[model samples]
Target: MWGLQPFYIPWYWYPCSTVFGSFFERWPLNKLELGMPRLGLLHTGIVLLLTLITELFLKQLGLDLFTTTTGPTFAAIWTTVGLGFVWQFNMWPFTELSQPTKGIVASIASLIISVFLYLVTVFLVGQENIIQGLYWWFNILWVQVFLMAPGLYDGISLWQDVPPLVEEQQPLSLNSEGR
Candidate 1:
């Protein structure tokens, strides 16, 4: 269950970027040409996989690192590092910014967001209410879906009808006048 926590945050963060970007015409993964929600799901899936693997590795190493006091902090740091790499590798390459500028900005932004989320989680879901607090956090994350309304509305208006594919003709005609 703890392994699943990191997965929830990205669902909120990415869609927020997407919904907001739709209004401003600025998207995070613009090169992919995918909907922001779709990108968010992909991002969440990747983060979840990495987080679970890292957790398992730590457990195997007998680190005993995820005490209540350390668990959120570790989660935040892991989230920051994971997202920084993801944005740098996946989104940054497609942007107009220079490599160093993009890398530094992305790193700092990821760290800030991770720390903010961590602090908010800690405040709202104090140590005694760990499970309950996580539940609330998950609930808050889902609120991001509401941000998709404008994008969805615009998409509805911009919907296009695609023509059906025509079947290919045989190379040789069955009833040719010339042999």
Candidate 2:
């Protein structure tokens, strides 16, 4: 577990591996190695993205995302939400993007999804019990969401619906002589 500083992180997901990290990092350095500016611009851009997302709650005062709070807890929730999308799900709708771009876009997309989720939760749970409702959402319900989201997007169920094994069939012998 390295420090893996993400400007705004060490990382993990329900299904996680260094393969995702390596793919994004090694490729960027080899392909888009723009000196230290790469670090500066990339990091700064992501930080700004975080700030902008946070502003959605901070500015509104009363509004907040699916996250617990609009501070560090918000960052934690955003990271948790993005991991399943970014890693297990292969950053859908942005998979064609380069590694750096994919990471950035998918992250912001996750934050957007969080906002959407907040609205949904509020509508369903109502404002009266928001704190308890969000707690249930992030802690309990999101586990199932993480497990299924990728499969749902990819048109598969994690527990695939297929036979476990197939019986071997004898090969048909062709009689070319008859033809």
Candidate 3:
């Protein structure tokens, strides 16, 4: 199951291997925003196409369509998630993302949040047995590969526009009417 197929890999996903390309062109590792990804109509269509192509490729690679039983299929999802995070980090391997302590704290926090969200989504989707496993696969692979990538990029770009943090004073007490 670990064998790499000799077929040509998809062009779009390959750019993740490069440093500058991955940071600017691919999805950022941390998801900073908490709402709908700002994909326009044309971008949405492209992402859907890319996701379908990736799913088909995974199916071709012998991933189980029925995920009811716990086996290689479920294991693959965990493996991919780990690999994805590692790969994203590798994009800046020689450089520090931030101070070591801050980076470690952020990394640990992000991992916890990611795990909690996955469990929540699976429960909310009403997935059970094999379907739950499939949902994991879909979310780990296609969702990140396509949907999250574009959305994350938009978020990072938008973040630049946010005003800097400023300290403001607050009144001690107030009344409904004049006081």
Candidate 4:
């Protein structure tokens, strides 16, 4: 239970990017001397493994209770905080902390932010209406997240390398031998 994603999808990219992305950026992972390719692979692996483990943990424990009670187990807030850490604050105060400890601190901070946002929403909407037809919220959130998609940034960074399409005068090559 990735907590109310469409069809209860657990491997959703947003939450994984938000939580694991920031977590890995801290301490020991950041200290690694890997180049761009290796670092990217490591980041991908860390996010995937953690996301799978979290999905298993959530499903095993039936964390769906947070679904009806709170939206996506406050995943939206976690995304907000996680993105804020990197894009906005550049992971400030936590920068001073050591490796694993920094990661722990960042995790705790995100959790705190999630809880605080949850409380604020509950206070405003009241407990009774927490789950009442709020699907639109996530729909818009999806688009918002899409605009910030990591691939877009990568493409922008590598714009000079983007391949151009074949010219109309260039006939198609049907096979390896150019038959």
Candidate 1 vs candidate 2: the lDDT winner is 2
For candidate 1, lDDT tens digit of each residue in 1-179?
Answer: 76753434333344233322322233234456787789768756644554455446545633223444334443434343333334323433424655445544654455456556655665776756656655554444345334322333331113344555787875785676634
Clashing pairs in 1: none
What lDDT tens digits, residue by residue, belong to model 4 across residues 1-179?
Answer: 55754543342455775555555553355567788888788867766676666556545534342234443635565566666565456567676876567767877787677567666766777667765323434554566566554543221123445687764575679898878
- In candidate 3, what are the lDDT values of residues 85-170, reduced to their tens digit? 43544323423454443334433443344445445545655435545654566567665566444433331244566787886866
TM-score of each: 0.34, 0.43, 0.31, 0.51
Instruction: State the lDDT of candidate 2 residue by residue for 1-179, as single tens digits.
Output: 38653322221221112222322433343455567877557644544554554555444755533333433334344545555564566556777887677655754577577667666666776777665554765674367456754444432122455666878886666885643
Q: What global local distance difference test value does model 2 have?
A: 0.49
* Ranking of candidates on TM-score, top first: 4, 2, 1, 3
TM-score of 2: 0.43
Cα displacement (angstroms), candidate 1, residue 172, comes to 35
> Where is model 4 poorest over a 10-residue stretch in terms of lDDT?
151-160
How many residue pairs collide in each prediction? 0, 0, 2, 1
Return the clash pairs for model 3, or none.
67-130, 68-130
